[model samples]
Target: MPRSPGGLETLDPTRQRQFSESGYLVLPGFLPEPLRARLVPEVDHWVDEGLRARSIAACAAPEAGGPPPVLELELAAHGELLTHPPLLRTLTQLMGPSFVFHHLHSDRHAPGIAGKPWHHDCEPNDRGDPALRMIHALHYLGGLDEKVGSLAILPGSHRRSADKTALAHLGTGEVPGETVIDRLPAGSTVLLDSALFHTRRPAPDGPGGPRYFIDASYCQTGARWRPVKPYWRHMLARARELGLSDSRWPELFAERHFTEYTGTV
Candidate 1:
């Protein structure tokens, strides 16, 4: 792997080529153990205290909304994870150094929770340039396996410009050429080009343990990207206030990278 002088893990040219061709990369045990430990408890608090519900309600009814009482990145460990050096380095190698923070979501999915349909999560940009990339870093805090279910992705699907849910007809059913990621050590992370088609498949055995998952996204900075959260400004502001970028990634929290928030319907 070719490493940048910044001392962060760099993707080898081969791996970078694979990501461009496949639209995803799996980094096993990407999150350091200590950080993973802190995040697990914080996730429990986020879900147990009804913050997750409130956050969803705010987004669903942004017109009737107050800001979410606590955004996911507002949590200390999450804030740290947002700027984790190795992850950022990998992202830089993949998306270039000038990328803006898009969003962060934290959740602990119970064993019986239903699978998500085949879909892509690429947000729109004002320039409408398909070449501009948006990537999501999916952190599997407790890892994934047969008991916890799996993630299935269509390789190279991101190359085509398509609607986020163009593959909805498939639901979570298997697709030709799909790659299923079912096993990883604790603290693994999967990086995906946001436009790639993916589906979540629940454990087939009908019961299992909770899955601790956190997903954060970033956009290659050139044109402004659309904001999914109505309170997008506040989210950026909070990230800046907390110095989450560590004075290293100047564009990471810059508001100029986003268009005004048009609530998701």
Candidate 2:
């Protein structure tokens, strides 16, 4: 990724246009090493202690009137990544500065993990406005290589109006015109238009090692977007309590941008 002469992170118009047309942007070694270092252990702990499972269960049974003891954003390094300055600036260039966070998920995929079916992660906004955008920032703390599964994405797919599972029946099989991203340096991040069709394919030669992955999403303001987790209100409140967002991005964790939780979509 290109940086300013000063070595500061920068997003130029050309890259912005590419993201618009390709439905994704690949940032090689985007996160700083220190940040990655801190995030790795956190992911291990999140999974090893079964906190990740509990978080998922909270999403599944949100009506239980409770959430997990700790949210992903509440994790020190995870919160830092969520509001990382470069990420926020790049996002502002792509979708403007007024967007609200959708969700954050952290996981360490074990070797031999099964592939995920082809799908999109976009949650609909109640206004039925297609222009309202949502984007996912997929942080690969350990990077990607042959040892782990690669991500397959359909370029320009976000332009189409379709269900999140429109391509589910196809599973993780190859698709013509699809691009396979199998190699990246540690701390790399992939920014995807939330509506883009994508799939996770297992390592070509079988699993090798755990994949340290975390994904956070944000939606453009102006419409009330649906929430993926039933405990979304609590999630945002906690983010605010932890001061995860900066003064510039007050809406980053504001509850006003989301519609009432209607359970998992």
Candidate 3:
């Protein structure tokens, strides 16, 4: 696999090809120190202050609950991250110039947290068109190491049309041809085709630091994609009200790109 050299501020021909064929791209040191420095504290607050839990509650059962008091994007640094220039440019290069924000998630994975089963995170668009793309940006704030845990990804698996949980039976077990990415620098990021099969392997037994991970997804515009959060409309409205991207990205937070929230499946 070809790793981005220091900065993936822009994708070159080779990087584009890698993503097209491999279903993923590893961008080491993609975030600047200053931006990352600001994001760390926000993650701490999101988790420590119970905001993360509140956010999840609103999604799991929105009829009885309202939007969380604080959204991840509302956090100053998180909001900036949602519209990071390099990320948008790379997405535009890979999935075309038009795409809408699908969702954003932030978490602090404590040491010895349970490993996640192998699965994909792709959300279906109403048109049922597989060609329409959705990409997930996995940001490693403090980076990955033996102690922080690693990500396992099955290359080219996105090409297969299977349910997201099709691979869950394997748990986090290593597959014959999967790639184990355990070593990376702070501020590194891995972009995956949302349909790509991947897993979060827990940190090896030892004293490990909390892993600060934030992920945001974007879907190419053409068809309305299913909304994961019932309060997604409110989320987008707040984003527009706050002018996260100002007037530059007309379609970034537009409500037309999504189907009505159908509640969790």
Best by lDDT: 1
Model 2 ranges with Cα > 4 A deviation: 5-8
lDDT of 1 by residue, 144-246 (tens): 9888999999999999988988999999999999999999999999999999999999987876989999999999998999999989989999999988886
Off by over 4 Å in 3: 1-8
Candidate 3 structure quality by residue, lDDT tens digits, 128-147: 99999999999999999999
Q: Model 3 scores what on Cα lDDT?
A: 0.91
**Candidate 2 minimal-lDDT segment of 10 residues:** 1-10
Worst 10 residues of 3 by lDDT: 1-10
Q: lDDT of each model, Cα atoms only? A: 0.92, 0.92, 0.91
lDDT of candidate 3 at residue 228, scale 0 to 100: 92
Instruction: Tell me model 2's lDDT, rounded to 2 decimals.
Output: 0.92
- What is the per-residue lDDT of model 2 for residues 49-166, given as tens digits with 9 covering 90 to 100? 9999999888888778698988999889999999998998889888998999999999999999999999999999989988888999999999999998899999999999999999
Candidate 2 lDDT score at position 227: 89
